[model samples]
Target: MTNFPNPDENHASARAGWEHIFRGGDIPPRYRSLAEPNPQVVEWADTLPAGGLLLDVGCGVGRHVVYLGGRGFRIAGIDISPTGIRMSQEISAQRQIPFEGHVSPMTALPWPAITFDGALSTSAIHHQRRADLVQALAEVWRVLKPGAVFIADFPSTDTLDYQDMRTRVAAGQLTEVEPNTFVDESTSPDPMEDLFLPHHYCDAADLRDLLRHFEIVRLQADLRPVTTAQGSGKVGKWVVWARRPMTT
Candidate 1:
């Protein structure tokens, strides 16, 4: 918290740092499984049709971007961190994955309506607050074509494992630098550190409520077992699946 920007500015820095870490392969061990396809990824991979636009939100290090691009889907990604975007770009180049990465927030994507055929976001939504979440969902709606698939997974209030991380960090044990704080407004950028939004943790029921805008094709909670690295607790991880409705 030293030499930190304003809360708003600090927030942006937090995001930027994550982007840098994502590219640098410095992702906290708790979140560094870019290779292992999570359950949400499994569902997304199964639903993705061949040769269509796939938007990879929060594309850390471009792992999925490279994979999906190789699968014949045109790809693009958005992330709050510049380092992440840069890393994705480098990885894309090194692996010959044809895709673009935008260093910006998903709430204000630089794309037009019906821009994608399929979309995926795994283990990265809790970084947004409720308002940001709604904005992000709206952006998804705006960019996704009718009947296109959209998948996302995030933390819920029931996700006490993350809470343990914070407690342990305070006690000087966990490797995580800090517990991302939820705030009223977005944070600003700091050259040294990044800011993030651990804004909302919607339970299954709560997610259902916010997902009213979408068709909500399906929903899953606590599907994966929480590892000791993630947290030593009974609460498991959560994920959700949804679809944009076809226009009548």
Candidate 2:
């Protein structure tokens, strides 16, 4: 755990670094997006019926936007960090993708309720405090249209990777240098990561409670094999797929 108490406002640089490191291979870039979306999210999306507005919440570099846009889907992305927004904009300009990348907190979406046809957020939610996370989910529920599907990825405290982190912290090899932030990967020689970000770990039960409003379609606890700096292990992250009820 970080020595500093969790900060109210997470640093934008951390999120920006997450984006850069992801491209260079650490955790997937989109993980900071509000959920640990399963890696094959795009495959599942390809199978689903097309022709819907796709909302990428907490979108960092706008990878989702570019991917969906390439498939001819109307996509929009939103994030809290100015650095993230700039990175996304630069890419959007280069690609000439029709996307609106905005610097906005996911908790307060600028769009109207029941506006989107479907949405997906990659690993962006861990940054929020529990209370705020609940409210954010509630807001997302409100904005989703009936029959709209929402998918998000989140980290689990139960993972071996997390356990390793705790062990390191307990041993004093790593220390929380700042609130809601830790300094392990930061000290490493790789420029991809300067330090690890503070993540709010959620168990399966925690997720079920947080997203009670939506009818869950699928939930993965140990999403895939545990991936770390060394190599892959047994279990790592998880993803949740759900839908707002057609009626409510």
Assess each prediction's global lDDT (C-alpha) against the native: 0.68, 0.68
Residue 20's lDDT in candidate 2: 57
Q: Summarize candidate 2's per-residue lDDT along 36-57 as a digit string, tens digits.
A: 3346567557755676777888
Give me the runs in candidate 1 sitting further than 4 Å from their true place.
1-11, 23-27, 30-33, 162-199, 223-233
Off by over 4 Å in 2: 1-39, 47-49, 172-196, 222-233
Give the lowest summed-lDDT range of ten residues in model 2. Answer: 29-38
- Write candidate 1's Cα lDDT for 1-248 as tens digits: 57433445534754855755564443354343447556566657766777788898888777788778767788999888776777778878887878878977767888889999988887665565555666778888789999987888766555565575456456644334223434322243232322233445556777787778788877766644455765454565556677888863
Query: What are the root-mean-square deviations of the candidates from the true structure over C-alphas?
Result: 6.1, 5.4
How do all models score by TM-score?
0.75, 0.74
Candidate 1 local distance difference test against the native = 0.68
